[model samples]
Structure formats: structure tokens, C-alpha cells
Target: MRRRTYLAGGASVLAGIAVSGLVSRPPSNERLLEAAREPSGTGEGSSNTETILSGTDHETSLYELDAPNDGPTAMVFGGVHGDERNGIEAAREISDWHPDAGTLVVVPETNRVAVENDDRRGVDGNLNRQFPADRGPQSELAAGIWDAVESYQPDVVLDLHRSLGIYGLHQEFVGQAIFHSPDAHGERLADRLNEDAVPWYLPFHRFTPGESTLSGPLLFQHAARELGASAYIFETTEFLLDHSTMVEMSRLAAAHVLELHGLLELGGDA
Candidate 1:
């Protein structure tokens, strides 16, 4: 059954809805400059060559690092929202990085327009919202990328994003970090995953999926599986950060993910 909901003002929200407009933070011009240069490709070893998703503005692109492996693949998609810096950063690290002997697909920014124009969605549309089947302007941009994802058939899909500065009611922001929404599955520790030093919720309750949001990891989690893929979301601390720090956190998560897949050089990379 399909349900439609609006973006909630507070943290606590229910699931199953079509959220319109941008979620929370939109990208600023300064943020867009982080990767002003044209995206290039790199696939050393058994990996395949990298490529960029070119927009009207060539510089505003999604650089994908495709490593060759026929086994169950892992897709690391970052920067679907221009304002969300952590995923993009992680994508960059993985591109240059060679993890294990398997296929790894890294898309630094699914929404290139958001990154380039420093906007949530691109000039034409919001890539994440547009995914799964976006024909473009007349329809949705979501199709292009999500289609790739479906065809890739990644066993796991890790999407990087931020927790919309929600606190108390929905989440809590501690200094640089912000806790994210729990999965529909009731995995408590899963909420605080990949963190260097953090504890699971002191109290647990029935998970309340955030604002039946438009499109994102939430949508992917439910939608992707139907296409032969599992999905996960990695939330970064709310707010903008220095490019370097963003890159580092992404690397940490990527390392953890690789380790989880047992592709980090056979054993013990985490």
C-alpha cells in the first residue's frame, strides 16, 4: 500500500508517505566548491575504469569507481543530497582505495546538481526523490541511478546522509554527531553503527520511521530489496565540516563496510 506524508517539523514521525520539497538543509555555494574540478575515473588492479555522470555543467558530476568482481557486489553511494557531505567524501576515499577482491561501486554524488548548484535537488529535480524510475524533467531522475543499482545487483547498499539536525524528539546531537532514526526492523545497536565511540540507546521503543520521506536510504531500503539488493544508511553529524574531516569519516565507514563483507584482504581490516 502507498502512503503520502509531509515533512515533519519535529523528530518523531511515522512511515509510508510521499514527502515533497527538500528534507532539511540545502547546499550552499561554498559547499559546492569542495569538488569544483571535473570528476575523473580510477580503477586499478581488477577494478574497472572510473567515469563521471555529466550534467550540463561537466564539473557537476558523479564519479563512479567500478571494481570488477562477479560475486555479490557492494554499492557505496554518497552525496545523493548536495548538502550531505559525508557520503561524497566516503565515495572519494573508496575510489582511490582498493578493497579486497570483489565488485565495489562508489557514486560520490547521485544528485550532481545539488552538489554543483549547492541545492538540495538539482536545477531539474531531486535525484534521490527521482530515483527508481525517473525519466527526467517531465518525470524523475531517480530512474538513471537506481536503474544502475538494480542492474548491479549489489548485495549491500550503503547510502551516506545527515540527520536533519533533529534532536530529543527524533534525534540527539552531541557536539559533532547526531543520532539517526532506528530501522523498521528493531535493531537498536544498528542506529549507532560504525561509530568510533558511542553507545546504543539507553532505552528502546518501537521504531518510528522519519517522515515517510520522499526518497533516500529509507526508500532504497524498502524499494531496493525488491530488485535484489539490501540497503543501509550512514548518518553523519549534522552541519557542514571541513572537507578533510568529511573524507576521513567516509573512509572509516567504508573500511568498516569492507570488513563486514570480509573483503578487506581476507580478514581483520576493521
Candidate 2:
């Protein structure tokens, strides 16, 4: 495979301003659409699908997009919690994304049973909590998902979710936040979403970055700890925002993370 440079010019510019406290103007909607439609590398890439947890009721399709050139791999999971419709839609859209020089692995609905039943936890319990720290996955569905993740060995892992309220405002909710591993660019991802995707009127909908807790048995935490991947859990608020906006925010978050990890390269400057 052809090894391509990790960070493109636009991506590097965004990273620079994200750290220096200088804000870059948001890209226009047209530009964002164009970027989304364009292929990342020299030519169109190939794609394939596989079934995880085969022969089981929880089985779901895993979509992979491979670039013509070699770059870091990114894995995105959605619908871990069935009620988070925005994340599931966003992941379905991201499944069609063409990388500039990397591999993109997307599991749009990890817990198929939960998604089908429209419940938070599948029959086996909360799939997110099944991957205990320093231990094997606690459920068969979790094990199957983990097996797929291990086989891919993604360099970056993004799990999409939604909550009923904002993180700071609601005691039990963690929405509009990015929980990330130390090595990941969670702050940058937050900045990007706040600048581009969020509207000026919705000041309360801004995103913030928080360090992922080691005590949690979450899938992202497990990936960060065991695979040494730059893992992130992106949460949006389903209360304030409409369903369309929620999906857009989720899509933007995923795209920005992919760009940060060199799995994508949007055209134009930051």
C-alpha cells in the first residue's frame, strides 16, 4: 500500500489554531457539503461489508472503506445505546465516506437487539458496560464486537451517543461532551463542532472535552487501555436540538475526528 502523509495542510492548520487560542472562521455549508461528497485521496476507494456476531439475533453489518494509499485506521461505533437515533444515522452516513489515505470501519448499530427493541440495553445488558477493564468481555455480543475491533486493530476509536441533557447542567447526563483518552484530540474535536456545526443562538449546546474515566467499563475506555488507540466517546444532547441537528452534529464530530487521525482530508482551509 502507498503510505500517505498523515496530516493534510487544512487539518494541520485547524490543529495549530485549536491549541493557540486563535479561532478560525467556520467553513460554509456549501464547502462542508462539497468536502463530504469528494473522495479523500487520488481516486475512489473500494469498500466491503462483513457480518459480526454471525448467526445471532444481535448480528449487524460492519462496513469498511479502504483508501488507495496507506494511513491510520479509524473505527466508529453507533447505536450502542438504542435510543440514540442521531448517532445511528450519523454512522450510517459515515459508512459511505471515502478516505484520503486510510481505512474506515463503521458499525452503525452495534447492539442490534437493542436497536430493534428501541431500548437502551440489549438482552445481555448495557453493551457499553460489558467490556470490563483488564478482563474479557462479559457478554457474547460484547465479545463478538471486541473480536471485530481486535481484528481491525484501528488506530483511533470513536463511539457515538446521545444524552437527555447537557453535561454540566444535568447531574446524570453527559451530553454535548467528548470523553476521550489522553492521547486523543478531544478538545480539537469539540472546538470544531462548536465553531462549525453549532449555531450562535444555542450557546448552551457547546461541546467540551473531558478525560475518559478509567473506572468505567465503557467500550471506548477499553479500546484506549487495551489497544492503545486514541479513543473518544461523543455525546450530543437530544433535548435542546432537533433530530436533524443532532444527526449533523454527530456527523461533524465523526468527520473531524477522522481528519485529526488522518483518515480524512477535507478540502479548503480551516
For model 1, the local distance difference test gives 0.46
Which digits, one per residue and each the tens of the lDDT, describe model 2 over residues 82-117?
A: 888989999999898887878999999999989988
Please give, for residues 175-239, the per-residue lDDT of candidate 1 as tens digits. Answer: 22322223222133233232341212212111222322323334355344355454555554432
Candidate 2: Cα lDDT at 205? 70
Model 1 pairs in collision: 4-18, 130-142, 131-142, 134-140, 134-143, 167-171
- Model 1 ranges off by over 4 Å: 1-44, 50-70, 131-140, 166-219, 239-247, 266-269
Clashes in predicted model 1: 6
Please report, as a residue range, the 10-residue window in candidate 2 with the lowest summed lDDT. Answer: 1-10
